[model samples]
Target: MSKSVDRKMSRGPSTEDIIEDTLPSTTETTVDKIEEISSLEKKLVRKIDLRLIPWLAILYLMLSLDRNNIGNARLGGLEKDLHLEGNDYYTALTIFFAGYVIFHIPSNLVVKRLRPSFWIAFTMVMWGICSLCQAFTHNAAGLIACRFFLGTFETGVGPSIPLVLSFWYQRDELALRVAIYFGSSTCAGAFAGAIAYGVLATMDGAHGIAGWRWIFIVEAIPTIILGLLSLVIMPDLPSSPNKRWLTPEERELAIQRTEMSGNTDKQFFDKKQFVAALTDLKNWLAVGIYVGLNVALGSYAVFLPTIIRDMGFASLDAQLLSIPPYVAACCLVFLISWNSDRTMERGFHIMGVSSLGALGYIFLLASESVGLRYTGAILVACGIYPIIPLTLSWVSNNQLGHTKRAVAIALVSMIAQVFAIVGTQVYRTEDGPRFIRGHAVCLAFISLSGISACVLRILLKRENTRRNQTYGPADVKDLSTLEDIDTLYDNHPQFRYAL
Candidate 1:
């Protein structure tokens, strides 16, 4: 059972005040930590954030552009140029997720095996090359091949990011960092629109190439440059022995933090943990949520420009209009994630947003009025985009060991990428102008996500309660003396899952 760690200089120090002061300040702390986060840990976290997040954010933005710019390109005449019709465009889109799903587990394992810096940077360069190749593709097969390889190479970075960030950040600190990383997608969405508008306006006829080709070339080059920069700039794992960027004390503390929370032993391959990940119910629940998100996201990324243009705007106006929703989405992503971290709450926030997103789809499906339908798009962006980091952080928060966490991350990601494949194929050109079927399917899935969050929260809460009854409430004071901890993991009596 747990007891309070009260430092009362005055007789009047309330129990609530002790709890408040003892809670994490600006530093990283474990679930049952007695002291506030130290200034040293806070400084180390800030240093890691500064050294790691910006370059990661930039590259993530480029990745989003390279992956989702196809919608923008289509508006700039990619379809006509490539002779894509009927199911050809959908096939190209589907191929990306096919490779994305196939490579998730393998890519994550490779990153764990090799140096994080080299592995991530290498994949970034490869994906950049694949993105560049898309600009030159003359037919469906060429585009599909390029897209497939692009997804394959990108698997190294995107799916493993939360898992990677988990190494450097604690459960308390990770949601916001992950949110910041995921926010790049919204920025890229906005940026993609603005860039497409500019390219279509200025570069369509220059060098006798289509504006869509120019879009690919412009986006691909920067990704390549950023990839090269990553070799020098990217931070390796916190547990890695050699960190030239960190001081000796800071590096020691960084490594210590990993071991402090639930015994994250340094094993690249733990078969027992891998098996645990394979059988975990929580991973599958997360997969449902992620699949719901990607279902909406895939359609939104690939079809938003077309949707806007279909709403009676010119192609250029549609491109320009697309930027606002993404900008709005990016802002909300920050606000929601910050609140989620501040309160240390996950499930309810995810539930609220997914429900709101489903309502947005309802508005879209029910309305023939163009203004109302556009409002629906804004609501959907605001609602759906924020759930991404929330869900990923929750998944990361629950897992115990490094290998189990890594495997769990990859497992959920691979399954979600399966639905991501479905996400691209849901939108048919026949249902175009107002793609009712895609909107309906997205609505159903988003609703499923909200319901799943509620159910999973209940399940986890019940399990935690049962643990308290059976094992006793988790006590921080008692936990420091724990031995042979690696074998127990989440089974350890003191380990608590964050709700």
Candidate 2:
């Protein structure tokens, strides 16, 4: 009987043997363990988002300083020294935007295919050179020419940084990061004034250059050096050798998560898709909001220093005064953005803050008191600056796929600049020493932004409901690969549009 049983065992598998054979293969188990480990690693890595946030914020701080310091210089007699008259100063501002508008989309497209280190750094270096040239401008034409080139090179910044962040963080995490980076403009506004203060007070004619010239030359130096350092330090994408922050396992998880979320390498810019995005009423709504908001921005960027200087202060003192408002603005921007991220809400926060700007402009227009006007200016600075970052983030969060987002970003920015052309012309010297018309125009536009934000919220909610009833997409999770995250645009049909 034992021999017979042994023969049967050898001829056919027992239940125990079958169960053993059904267990995972060694290779399969190992792969499973690797995947589990990889996932754990990714969760660990994403926790340190703070580290990257500051660097990006600082980069933008410098960008804002470079871009708007001209206002400070204007207060320090740049107009007088350069012999700018009538509308030359405004012309220079407009020329800068012209170049900025022309090159924006191209810069973004190039950055998509190239390493940010080279393109961003190269842009920084070029803009720095242009900034340094401002110290030597002998007339309005030279300043305008330099401003034009400066705009051309600096165009890489406003769009590329947010796009770059999208490569590292997911959508829900982006608003605050965008705010943090955008908040640096507040730092630029706050600090540039102070720096201009010291430079003007101590070195008005240092090295045979005017104080305004010194401001331009001194500010450009640090930016150029930082641009070079960024080349070595800024992490490339996951496939890059410099990507030490994310382990290979983590990278695979990143890739896997993105793919599972429907962020595949599909071309997002089908002609039909482009037409759909373009004709979408929501995109146009965003355009109108951004345009109005940017008009406020353009006016502030060109006139903040002048307004401060007009407030019973010297050129240096005006620069010093400019700091506090920006500092306040930065803090508020961060607070709002953090709350937005925490709550997974955007439209309300954006609209609420933008309305604050309208109030600021109204107060400034109505009051003759310096203190009241100054308070209003602070509110204006805070309110106006946050909108662009918030708007960009909103668009980015709402859009799905890369090409569509890229196009959307480019479209919003270019159109905003088109409005900026109009806004830049608002604060003519003829209207200054109290720009009543400019203040009124700014208030009107800020009101426009508020209305648009509310309208957009309604539109998004409806769209989200429609999508929920249809495809039932997932929610936004991955920050870096936002372009591929499908759930953000509301794949689910029922619970859509959390505005």
Off by over 4 Å in 1: 1-37, 477-484
Q: Write the per-residue lDDT of candidate 2 for residues 347-461, one digit (tens) a residue.
A: 8887998889988988788888999999999999878877877888877765555555666787788888888887888876666667899899988888888889899988776
Q: Find the candidate with the highest TM-score and give its number.
A: 1
Badly placed stretches (over 4 Å) of model 2 are: 1-51, 260-262, 266-274, 469-498
lDDT, candidate 1, 1-499, per-residue tens: 2212111110111223333444656455453453333655667878999998888889889999999999999888888999997789889999999888888888777786787789888999999999999999999999999999998999878888888888777666778898898999999989999999999999998898888999999999989988888888888887677787898978877766655555357677888888888888888888888878888988898889888888899999999999988999999998899888766678989998998899889989999999999989988998889999999898888887778888888887788778877678777767878899989999998888898888888887777777778876655432224665566656566666666
lDDT of each model, Cα atoms only? 0.81, 0.72
TM-score for each prediction?
Answer: 0.91, 0.86
Residue 93 local lDDT, model 1: 93
